[model samples]
Target: MVGVSVLEDNLKDESLILGLLDRHPIGVAAVFKRKIVFASKGLARLFGWRREEMIGRSTRIFFSDRASWEAFGERLYRLLEERDDVVLEWPLQKKDGSPIICEIITRRLRPLGDDWIVLSTIRDITAEKRSLRRLKARSSSLRLELSGALEALRREKDFLRRIIDLVPAGIGVWGPKGPVLKNELLRGLLGENIPREIPHLVGRLIRGAGRVFRFEEEIQGRHLLFTLSPIDDQNILLVVEDLTSCVKMREGLETLAQAKASHLLSQERLALMGRLLAGLTHEINTPLTFMKTNIQIFGAYVEGLRRLLEGAELAGEKRKTIDKIISEIRDITKSLEMGAERIAEIITSVKNLGRKESFNEEIDLGQALHEALILTHNKIKHHLRVFINGEPYNRQKGVPLLGVYTTGRRSLLVQMMVILINNAAEAAQRRRVKGATLEINVEDIYPRVVLTFRDNCGGVPEEELSRIFESFYSTKEEGTGLGLYILKEIVNSLEGTLEVECPKEPEGLLFRIVLSGGGGGVERIFNKTFYKGVQDGHQGIGTG
Candidate 1:
């Protein structure tokens, strides 16, 4: 009866323990020789299986694969032999073959002959592990972001420091207690003992009175402008600017401007004097013309009287008297003629001093060239073959093929063109070159007109070319040297540029003239007039 009661008591204890294990939140299982010998209801539910199905099942069935099962078995047995319990986190499979992460704690319950009985508790930790991974990733991202922000802030601070150092003016910042920051300029201006030197100013700034103060002072012989401004309730900004150089520059500029004004006034007076002289010369030319004509007539009369006396039969005294009268008249007339001629030459020499007229006229450069060619035909016809805008010069055509226009006096432009052509022809004659060709091109590069005169007449010496436009600087024996100089003056008056170049390949001189072009409105008017003239069988420059 006693043995029976003890057996019943042992069975009841085992049942009560299994019932408690089943009721536990964690899964519990017992494994002997790598097979489940007992499984709690919690264990079966953890693996998505019935308790009856879990019992007598191999531990490999709970593992995802054979490799994991073997690895777990090796670790489990190795750790069980060395310690009381083994704790591991492993990926396992449920009854549906779905994956789960589990934290397993196994203990060696006892030794059953050659094998050992082990009790294990399993906890599904997939969600917890996933949450922990997310937290780790978030922490790493935040760390990276914070590090980038700090680096950027550091770079920004360095940039601001460099900017502050580069500022030309002295800059200082003051806090409530004392000076907070000072740039290099400020340090050099105030020195290290800034607080002691400017105690009153520092006290005022520290008061943070919301008023701006500005003053100028001479410190160490340097003029400086000081501006004190409140930045906020706790800080003040001070800007110091040195004005010594500025004051000196202003004085210098004022003096220079006065001198420049005086110079311009003198130039204006001189220009006025030149205009007056030109006008006087013009007035003198009118009388000189009549005087010259009268002298020629009187000289002709004297010559006739002398011829008659030589042919007449007369007494010696009468003949001598006639001869004396004729000689006296002839000498007087010759003297008068020579004087008039001298005055005329002087008038021509200073012709450029005269104020230019008809400057408002829009002159067709091509027409100007055509007129100039006609006027100079006698001089250049024999030797020079001129091409106007790439076409052979035809004097009979009257009008050039190209019609580039610019704003200038027609007469002056014609005169300028004449000078260029005559110069080119003379140069060609001097060189004595065969097939001396002169190419005159007009290009309408909008807003400007470019006229190019290229000639195959041996160019001038390099040394002489630079002084070619100087007054009285001539290369020819008979040249007055005023042609190119006057040409330059005319070009300057018309606001144009003249450049001379001597080419090596063709061995000739090139003259490039650039002038403001008559705009589209003027061109349209020109075309209209040109076509109208063509219909009327008239060929010439269009009237404005």
Candidate 2:
């Protein structure tokens, strides 16, 4: 009673202590006199027992297979032996027969004269242990999934990019907004001025445009065929294809086609038209011939009438003069009779072009070639050198390549040849090399005429070679790009095939045309059926 001792009074009452223990998630246990005496609510729950069940039980009993926790028991006993107060951590058992690791603080209680007791407070770390285990498992799973996604994406992207890079044409993708471009392989084509921000680029792309357009555009000094398509009606995806080389090819093909077209026109307008012209002009010739003869007869009749009039006047007066006038009329009747010749010859020749006859002629491919050469002579006269080999030498070489048509349309054959020769000429010109010459070889292959046209002006680029027959593709400024395409049309129409070969050995373009010389065929009509073909338009082609 000398002073109020803090050790004797329990200001932290049972309720307060229980409340504090309940607030903590860690398991707690207490050991008294070196035995398990009490445990917090959490510890009891972890051990699958009520607090009363464990209050008097030894700490050793908490281990399911008691030997498993013997290490921790040894640690506890050593701590108790060293001092009355000890702080320790160890593994114990849970209700599920699993280990619950814990840390504990043990203190000696000396109250009411010589009675010594050990109070051990334990904190269960099982929740933390489970959390750390879950965390480790989740981390491992996430790592594996992310790694798989990354690896799959890497492989697929690499494969796609390799294919794109192999393509000669530069390919790119722009988002719906447009200035932002995403192209794995085409970035190299963009070169120096690539944008740092994709969003900014995308904003710039669709800034003003409303509709997608596919057309040629020169952007940043690069010629491109910008094919724009709005993906999902919001994003404008543009493909910028470089077409500087294509345009050049068209100009060269156009030049050759123009010449061949000129030759066909000249032939139609000149020698072939002469006979038809003679017939059309016969309207004036037949009428004029009859008119001339009648005039001559009238002159002779006038002289006789004049003489008769003079004699009648000399007979002096009435009755004699009337009779002489009547006799003059008889001679005039004879003059009119001689002028009634037929007008039949003039009508015969006028109907020549409308003849329903078809041409089944043994079409000399060589002769057509010669005519075409003569016609396009000016195209190659000054700037080109031409050589011919393997032409039919002797009469035996004529394989009788005969073509028959029940319908009269021989003119299309000429047109077909014109197309072929013109394309060759254009290819030659586009090559534009010094001392460039075109060489032709004609060989008879039984059922076909094998004509190979080659030029020393250099071959077409490998990239443009396949699309040489595509319409509207051109590398030249003034090219319509329809020359070789039309030539192909004409050849195919005549049941023939045209193939282009680029010789790696000689490094020039060699075009081989195999013609089936049987019948001018049904293909010569210039009507609706003949003109309608596959969607191929007459555009830029002629390289191949």
Encode model 2's per-residue lDDT on 385-487: one tens digit a residue. Answer: 6665733222112112212222113444555555655655666676665776667776655555667787666677899899878765664568766667766
What TM-score against the true fold does each predicted structure earn? 0.34, 0.30
Query: lDDT score of model 1?
Result: 0.72
Worst 10 residues of 2 by lDDT: 535-544
How many angstroms is residue 442 displaced in model 2 relative to the true structure, after the best TM-score fit?
2.2
Name the regions of candidate 2 deviating beyond 4 angstroms: 1-362, 390-410, 424-432, 518-544
**Best model per TM-score:** 1
lDDT of 1 by residue, 1-544 (tens): 3222322433335544555556555687777788777777878888899977776778888988899999988887998889876779899999899999988888765566697777777867786676967644543343333222322223244323333443346866666677766777888876753433344565675585446667777767677777666655566667777778878889889977976686578679978998788788889989999998988888887888788879899999998888888888888887788667656655653463244757677766665675577567778889899987787776545545455678977767777788889888998888798999999888888889998889998888899989999865798898767789989998888899999999987888899989888457445645765676777876554211
Best by lDDT: 1
* TM-score (C-alpha) between model 1 and the true structure: 0.34
